[model samples]
Target: MVQAEPETAACMALRDELLGPLRKQTLSTEKLCEVGRLFCGAPERMSLYGVAAPHMEAGGVRVRGRTAVECTIDEYAGEAADAVALYAGNLREGSESDPLVVDLFCGSGNLGHHLGRRLGRRVHASELDPQVYETARDNLSRVGSGVEVEHTDYRHLIARLGARTENDVYVVEPPWGDAVGAVGLDLTRTTPPVADILADILRARAGKSCVVVTKTTTETVCDSLRNAFRGAAHLCSFAPSAPGAGVEFHIFRLGATDQP
Candidate 1:
């Protein structure tokens, strides 16, 4: 088990107090700050720790410090994980070769861990942030299978893995934006900017199948994908399950045209 930082320990303590019964209720700014100050010690630090409350409640689990702060708590919901698994199953159906599952931007290994168990495949997951990577590594290790987690840049991983072969499936869910709100059409606004690596991602998996699953407010990124992959691309949108929840997903599948 990885140790939590002092501030993160503070945040987790607050999470425990606020998540259970008060989960549904929205706390006033002053009241929330007051609660946060109990563990975080100061007003400014309390503000930082307070950000973890919603995410902790959503994820329903505790992890290491930086990971709890940097990564989305419950980003890969049950339905979304099922959708990705279903797609993988369909892609692998009647396939002759054993496919490898590579999660390019595995934050806390949520999607990768789910897919590893669901698909029973050799999964390689990576995160760039060292602290988050350690969290992912520890989390995936508990799964007790062929899941390998790495602390490296996605491009570096791709380079080391070399060219993609047939039956190799790459799943990417890059950071769309900072907040949980609407991620606009501009791909450049994303942390790694999908546009910057779309070509590389395609080239790496040139002869194989790859899926880029993301959440966005507009169809601009979809348009960009379609343009890049031509008729080889397929895009689908999943409506939000709840009224206040944002639109769930924008899935882009490529290389299926050549699949047998």
Candidate 2:
């Protein structure tokens, strides 16, 4: 992944010159960044992924909520379907007495809700933020497929997961925060490096049949993920997919054949 263009104070000033910083900003960080990309040299029409936005504004950053979710859903609504297909395909290859789905950082139960309803599997999800956790609980509760959600850090959830069967599937889509560096989104910069989260999951599963459905971006850099998986993650998308839509998912099947 490339480092996004620095949206430092000076660069932000450039953006302010055109948009004016004094106003209550209505544009998302991405929209603002895309605009930044326009003035920062890249004039190509953008999906925010083809050409990394590479810029930022101080006042316009969003902490989190529906705005981010709406933008994300628009970009990556296909990933959930892809994940469901992946899990179905995995079941075709092997059998488990009881298979479970997990979401390490379930924001508002979107992934888990879809997986539970579509796959008819027990979905376990956790969210750190109290407000987000409430939203996740409410959504998943309506699924009626017994999706369990916890309001706690993912690390704590990992510790309580106990022993896993051979067919347990894990999904991770940590909070990416509001900043994207010059080149692109760095996996290491996530709340807690995604590699570490995956590694912990692998250890908990104990070298059994494991699969990770992870959220990614077009410009995501993965030196660390490669090292951890010891295998490449296959990029999957929704039907009628757009390459630079700014949303991506990587599926990694690592189990008995993995390296130390």
Candidate 3:
């Protein structure tokens, strides 16, 4: 039998190490395949995900992916950012300068970093988890100035900011369920239920301000939004990339009822 080269052996070992725990989870075959690709890259990139090499990439920009799972944001975060920018523009009519963008739950700072660069706006981002917050700080640091990533809860951060302007936009992508592979049709099951924050979000929104939430598809989310906010609300579906992916985002919009 032929022996594997040192580099090939290292890659395989690292892949096994990263995929070991993931395999034990309820991840679908498609998710497993995606995770497997993290190890097939340049040995350096593989090290970034496997070992302590600090780096991340999303939308063609380098980020800090502390773990293999962190790299998955690269697949869909860009599209989500695009949706944000479109809604922001629609919310505020003829704003000469970029709006104040706040990401309530900035995982890895992917959406916040993308918006900061794309819109040239001052972005305020927060993450509750300290370890993930460190990764987010590192990732946003590489982007440029005007982006702030804080290791703080979203509610506290919002409170500190106080009253917002018509040019303020808030973005939230909360954990849908308890576990990584958990699935459900109820938005309340999400960590920090959307209902808990809806009133505060509505009060924080200026006349032209907008709130964008990316959530797992649920039949009740739309009605919930409408009942909470008297302003215009729109919910659009994002199809999953794979047939059995089991993850789809419903981008919910509130505020700016008059925008065409």
Candidate 4:
């Protein structure tokens, strides 16, 4: 009974029907090699379902100070940022102080900054990696992005801020190795597991409503996610059709909260 159930169901159905074939499709090693050469990461990340060098795929190289450092699929990241902003802004449970948009495993704050700006709301980003956290804090500060970059664990962040708030949105894109597989993404494999993360979130909310938009590959297995996060909504940017060019988004909504 969430805001966009019917639309989300259509997206999920398409992905489910096409997932098997997509998994069988050969994953080109060229992109993997290129990314691997450009950025050192886990071997699993070297796949078509892995991270890109800069995440600013098409436009240009420089990335406006947010360069190869941030690990995101630029195409989907933009779509998701826009989607999250729009989604959060329309939440029926909006509080006096606009609901917070939080990013989990936020790597340099590029996506978070964009989301904050697009949402026109307060945003908080958390990075476990010290180096990345420092970089995000400094860069966001210099640019005056107005996002609060925290060097803390996601669990703690959720427990602290995930109380039954009026409206809040979370963006999650965990690492490829544990989260994504060579053939498809696995929620159970994700570090700390996506289900575990969701459990914490649900527990914190205590039946309150919220949204979690997680970025996954086109090859992501629908069944895994269905079991891990039941009733979640799907947002297909270009994933099922274009595959490598874009990514998939699974939006997990806690309860019924109609949109404006």
Candidate 4 lDDT, tens digit per residue, 131-172? 557755765675677579899998788778865454677777
Clashing pairs in 2: 1-221, 2-183, 2-184, 3-182, 3-183, 4-181, 4-182, 4-183, 4-184, 5-182
RMSD of each: 10.2, 8.8, 9.1, 11.0
- Residue lDDT tens for model 1, 57-169: 34332344333323322323344556666654443433555566777887666656656556666678778867567655755565354558788888878767754444455
For each candidate in the order shown, give its overall lDDT on alpha carbons: 0.52, 0.53, 0.51, 0.55
lDDT by residue for model 2 (68-169), tens: 222233124335645656653543322554666788877645566556555666678888777567655654454343568999887778668844555566
Instruction: Kindly indicate the candidate among 2 and 3 with the higher lDDT.
Output: 2
Candidate 1 off by > 4 Å: 1-66, 69-75, 89-95, 143-146, 163-167, 177-185, 206-209, 217-232, 240-243
Clashing residue pairs in candidate 3, if any? 56-63
User: So what's the TM-score on candidate 4?
Assistant: 0.65
Off by over 4 Å in 4: 1-70, 89-97, 164-166, 233-243, 256-260
TM-score for all models, in order of appearance: 0.62, 0.63, 0.62, 0.65
Per lDDT, what order, best first?
4, 2, 1, 3
Clashing pairs in 4: none
- True-structure lDDT of candidate 3: 0.51
Count clashes in each candidate, considering only residues at least 3 apart in sequence or on different chains: 0, 10, 1, 0
